[model samples]
Target: MTAFNPITISCFKAYDVRGELDVNLDNAIAYRIGRAFAQYLNDGKENPVIVVGSDIRPSSESLKQSAIDGITDAGIDVIDLGMVGTEEVYFATSHYNAIGGIEVTASHNPINYNGLKMVRENSRPISGDTGLADIRAIAERGEFVVADKGRVTLNTDKTAYIDKLMSFTDTTKFTPKKIVVNSGNGSAGPVVDELQKRLGDNIELIKVHHTPDGSFPNGIPNPMIIANQKATSDAVIAHGADFGVAFDGDFDRCFLFDEKGRFIEGSYIVGMLAEVFLKKHQGESIVYDPRVIYNTENVIAQNGGTPAISKSGHSFIKQVMRETRAIYGGEMSAHHYFRDFAYCDSGMIVWLLVIELLSVTGKTLSELVNGHINDFPSSGELNFRLGQKTASEISELLEQKYHSSNPAKNTLDGLSLDFGNWRFNLRSSNTEPLIRLNIETKGDKALLKTKTDEILAVLDECGAVSADH
Candidate 1:
């Protein structure tokens, strides 16, 4: 039996665990979290097993080993999937019938940080509302039931996962087209390579930064960062590709770019995917976050599907998907969830669907999305770094200013107000210390810009600096 050593861990987040290295998270804390996760899932089960994976971060391997140690110490066998994306852990957890799974990945955080995203059986998310609080409490208490150590097995085979991805679209119908794929030197590179081999010769891929380097030689894998987008955009234009796709550190969320190197807003992609799913599964419920709604709502309504609104986080979206039996769910932040994919979001699956859409429609990526963009001109998610003001204070101030307009108001996730032809959603980010604002005007670019500027001015008055600047 291990001696009890209670230590406070501050790495636990609303959804996953994240913190700066050696400060809020370290080997000891990781070990405790692993043990806690196993204990929480054990529940009188015999020889419970857990799947573990990690991203390409420098600290991930060691942290993963420590976590595996903790799980094993709790007498839970582990299946290590080697270095892989977060979704792979999700898939493996369900694929192997494991009781739980954890992916040691900070995913687009600064190089100095690393953390874990965990899930229970059947790839169900383990957020604060579910089992994360209990796991955290167990870790903090540092007490465990004595049991014989469990064994660890190496299972790096991704054939099953690759097969699952290919099942989303028929490659036979995929027209011969060139595509620029920028992996940003993260874990996506290997997955992309494997996908390329399976894709055969019909699709030509122009790979950029397609190497897994923990040092982040190109930059952080987050294409949402304007600075990081230039690589994929430039490659798309330079190669005259059909379209471009880029993935974050863990490859869970992918960002798309048009042939003209224009970064397609995630809201528009959500609308496009909603249309795709609704066409195939008519009258089914589709879940979307309240952050950006006009385009998605319009599309779902047009396609004979019901639109179910959910909060902005993955856990909330997944729960709503299950509740509504949604055929698909999307967030403006590039997280796309599928009913068939265990209600888990996958960056790879999204791009594949986009590819199939393009092939089936025979339309340029821009051509396919242009109608939605024009009909609902939007200010794609502008983030503001708060100064001296909390998000709640700013929300109250904004409400005070806008509530007099008698617009339709909804606080499903944050503040959403619709004044007939125009609307906006102002909310705080779940992960970062920032406020996200999204606005859209019905086919009115002038109004979109004017309202965007007006909102920024009000935010400026509150000492909130634009993160884009």
Candidate 2:
């Protein structure tokens, strides 16, 4: 579609399209991506409709224009949703029966980060192993001609989406009181603020950095990072709210905290939400990432449903959710996907469900999670920035040296060693080049700690330097 050089274009990535600015990611790349998708998928129609949305990131606005140009070059009509969350982008795409869709966001990555997540017609995800590879190949080759030039127009449906969000739960359902939310100045701020305005103090609110700021002054907006969560945890304690909520850059995922300022493990949230969703939609399947508490499988089964373990990635989880028609799917990373949301992950939906559950039960977040806490003692994700490329070698060594004698081993996502009572999932970071280690024990916290220490020692001993960030 647009005439662009092949060498200068490389915004394509495994799960989506992301790269450095100018060098790898720029207007040219964005335009090429738009053109590639339009030409590859939506051709022929005078105005093949596609929904496009962008985040608050500085580089996104210009790049978004380039994408629109690309799409128009291929004779596609663009419904620009303007600045919104990635989930909203998905919602617009599916809601309007668009031929293709694109959401411009960098998510939890640093300030310099920028990227795009695209899907074919009818909200089908373009994942790495599935369709992203083909997109990448097209982007790399970068030699396509535009058959028709189309147009992009601004469309405002955020209010309609907000209405849809509130409609999920009845007004009389539950009035969760005194909950603190931290948006970290990401795109979720406005949405959360709107929810507060609409809900009108049904839940007491404590807002932290509610304004949008692409430069995450508090931190990188990732609540999983203890440092980034300091402000949120502190606010929860200061306000004595029922729970704390947080959102990353594009706000597709949400992380939580208990009343006592304790960070709630994502594993517990998955179990709680699974139970709630399954209760509403009886006998449905629930999808979950394999890196969470093993008890999640038991909880889903006990709730009169099926449990499907998926790889640790939004794209993969989404794929599995669609294939199984799972009512709910969650990742230990706080990315929650719902069948109601077209199998797309939504931080807002998960937290909304949480608020409803807490409101109806009149129980504190701590009380709700207490039942799921001791199911397993887990060493939350420990990241190591290996200066060497010996991650595979080290993983093999660990498997041969320790996991070899385990009761059973599963390498579905990475190296998952299962000893029946205690297990660990060693997985590599999808976005970053890091080997992340996770250890869990059914009834042994001491054993979990010991194993975690051993893995750290190995990382240090190997030909690499270790840094959590």
Itemize residue pairs with steric clashes in candidate 2: 99-121, 178-204
Q: Which residue runs of candidate 1 sit more than 4 Å off their true CA positions?
A: 1-3
Error of 1 at 396 (Å): 1.6
* Cα lDDT for residue 73, candidate 1: 91
Q: What is the C-alpha local distance difference test score of each model? A: 0.91, 0.80
lDDT of 2 by residue, 97-171 (tens): 888899998887777778998887657788767767766667668877755577778986588788878876665
Name the best candidate (by TM-score).
Answer: 1
TM-score of each: 0.98, 0.95
Worst lDDT window (10 residues) for model 1?
Answer: 1-10
What does the lDDT read for residue 294 in candidate 2?
77
Q: Which lDDT tens digits does candidate 1 get at residues 1-469?
A: 5667887889888899999998899998999999989989997777689999999999999999999999999999999999999999989999998999999999999999999999999999999989999999999999986778999999999999999999998888888789899988889988898888987687899999998999998888889989999999999988999999999999999899998999999999999999998898999999999988899999998999999999999999999999999989999899999988899999999888877888889999999999999999999889999987888888788788888898898898788889999999999888888899999999999999999988888889889988874
Q: Which clashing pairs does model 1 show?
A: none
**Candidate 2 ranges beyond 4 A from true positions:** 1-4, 43-46
